[model samples]
Target: MKKIALLLFPFILFTFSTFAQSANEDWISLFDGESFDGWEAAENPETFSIEDGKIAVHGPRAHLFYMGAAENHDFDDFVFKADVMTTPGSNSGIFFHTQYQEEGWPAHGYEAQVNNSFDADPRRTASLYNVDDNTEVIFPDDEWFTMTIQVEGQHITIMVNDEVITDYTEPEDVDRGTNVLSSGTFALQGHDPDSKVYFKNIKVKPL
Candidate 1:
């Protein structure tokens, strides 16, 4: 009996160690280079199209989603990275902890904004969209930029082209008018008609 217990103890420890290692792996690709298999659109009625090995938002619609049925997955803390390109006045965002609904902007999740210049709105690019403030202009429209967002607990960090732009932690007990750093599905926002946004090399690492 003593020998059997010893063997089981090591087996349990090894199993847990392997699980921890898998959770910390760097950069799991969200976009499969061929399809939007694991992603979903958000509030906009706009359609997300795949062309030339890239996922793009095209055509006219409010908001659309490509999520798994019945909220099967959600992320609480993770590092998300994607390469995005947009037209001059194009506006889009990476929405986290997103709740899917019909016809309206997501009231639950947070948006890691995407914009170019100050063309559409001064708060256009890289802004936290009403939750926090955006001060720097780090996006160059029509040019590819690498955007990275790290969410750990209640703290969030936004980086563009490896440059730290927006770093904020949500205030505890403060009402941001929505859910705060809970957990839900991840989404890509397609804002308005005629707004074209392209996403590639999308990856995430859970913390």
Candidate 2:
């Protein structure tokens, strides 16, 4: 019995160590907090700025794409999360399964709408844009809220402050030509000049 116990002890230790290492490796930060090191800004560069450990978006129309050095800044199945805060009447969004665009709105990927008291769009915070949109004003303006998104295969889930909000599944026959869902990098939106939003702790865990 003593010999059997000794052999099992080593095997258990090895298994635990391997699991912990993989979990840590799976998570990667898209933002470094001090600068836009692994990201690319399109259109107005002044729109995106780093202030007080947060990515502040407040100037004009622009989109910041994650161009990090991981898998060529491409992720297929992963969990994306960020701490976001919006001002009153502000509007913004986070895009997933998207690519870099030199000008105009990104033609690819899906937008997870970030809105609080904005009167223009009915879609509120933690919404999956047009697809399975969420209209509840879950978060208050000027306060930070944690938004979490999980995408695996055709399934997509969104949460606000750890509360499940949207659970959507893309149809198998969904068109792939236009706003259809596909694998790509992530992006942060600067909706307009008046809209002020802050984002931080942006990270992802590939599945």
Candidate 3:
């Protein structure tokens, strides 16, 4: 009986360890369904808000930001996934490695373009915006679309709804304006007036 109990103890310990690791490995939800506890606005708290279990970008021309101060969780190599929906002709973006600037847009960062309209320009959505990297069309506006960005070192790839869009590597010694590609905070853009955007299911895993 003593020998059998000793053997079972190891098995029980192993099972508990496995279960704990699995729970921690799961994706962390950035937004709580009830409140914006882990976020903040770029300029003012009035710009961004939580509405009906989703982060809503209101106003027509204000650049509202979701503050990421809880972890200061900067990533060097990781995979980011989010579900996004926007109004027609609305122009916004997902900014990464962004630094705050006073009274203007964040000068330092890269924007994952988010625009969806038949008349919308190619650079309007899913394009690397001024960085000159273009990907095939894979935007499903008027509904929810999954946007995934994978960054490994200097190489970055973006996929919209399982469709590969921008896949390019940063040129060595090239200037990235104010946008620091290696590491910084992540944010959602609120461009111009009347532009409403919704973001949900945002999760990130380190590479």
Candidate 4:
């Protein structure tokens, strides 16, 4: 038993070291948890606020875009992640490959639906909104959950709680006008005044 433990110690240490190095080297936190230094809001700019050390989305229609120094807020292939919590009947979304719009819903990129129990929208959390809409409720409301969106080339994948929910591949002839897949920054949506959502640990890694 002592010999086996000694042999495994080196492997365990090496594994941990690799993980730490990879995370530090690749991932970048988009939110500072205390300020919006790297983020910019559109339309109802007041729709987002830092409360309890998390982004509080509690106002009318608005989109908050990432416009900081990281990659100049421009990403072609990357993984965007955040911890989110939605109140009952709330609606929100995370947009990737989207640019900042002065007003109204984002006109670019794709929306990974952050809705779990919103009675108004049939799309559930982690849905590739419209394009690959999901109606299954995979996670519950009022709880912290991790959502990740990975884009590589023409393929897009969305996960909730580290579980795959939506896997989309943009076709060669596919065209949805401004909503088509393209390289751009990320955005957070404040769906409506009635919906309240929380987001934290926002991060991304360019690939």
Error of 2 at 19 (Å): 5.2
- The stretch of ten residues in a row with the least summed lDDT in candidate 3 is 62-71
For candidate 3, lDDT tens digit of each residue in 2-84?
Answer: 99999999999999999999866765566766776755565544556777777777664445444554346565677788889
Can you tell me which runs of candidate 3 are displaced by over 4 Å? Answer: 1-26, 64-71, 118-122, 133-137
Cα error, residue 140 of model 3, in Å, equals 3.5
lDDT to native, each model: 0.74, 0.91, 0.71, 0.92
Q: Can you tell me which runs of candidate 4 are displaced by over 4 Å? A: 1-19
TM value for model 3: 0.79
RMSD of each: 6.9, 2.9, 4.3, 2.4
Report how far residue 74 has shifted in candidate 1, in Å.
Answer: 0.5
Expressed as tens digits, the lDDT of each residue in 1-207 for candidate 2 is 999999999999999999999887788888888999999999998899999999999978999999889778888899998999999999999999999998788889888889999988999987888878877788899999999999999899899888999999999998757676678999999999999999999999988
Q: Which ten residues in a row have the lowest lDDT in candidate 2?
A: 174-183
lDDT of 4 by residue, 63-153 (tens): 8999999999999999988999999999999998899889988889889999999978899999999889999888898899999999999
Q: lDDT of candidate 2?
A: 0.91
TM-score each candidate: 0.79, 0.89, 0.79, 0.92
Per-residue accuracy of model 1 over 88-151 as CA lDDT, tens digit each: 6787888887777776777787888887753656675667776675856665778888988888
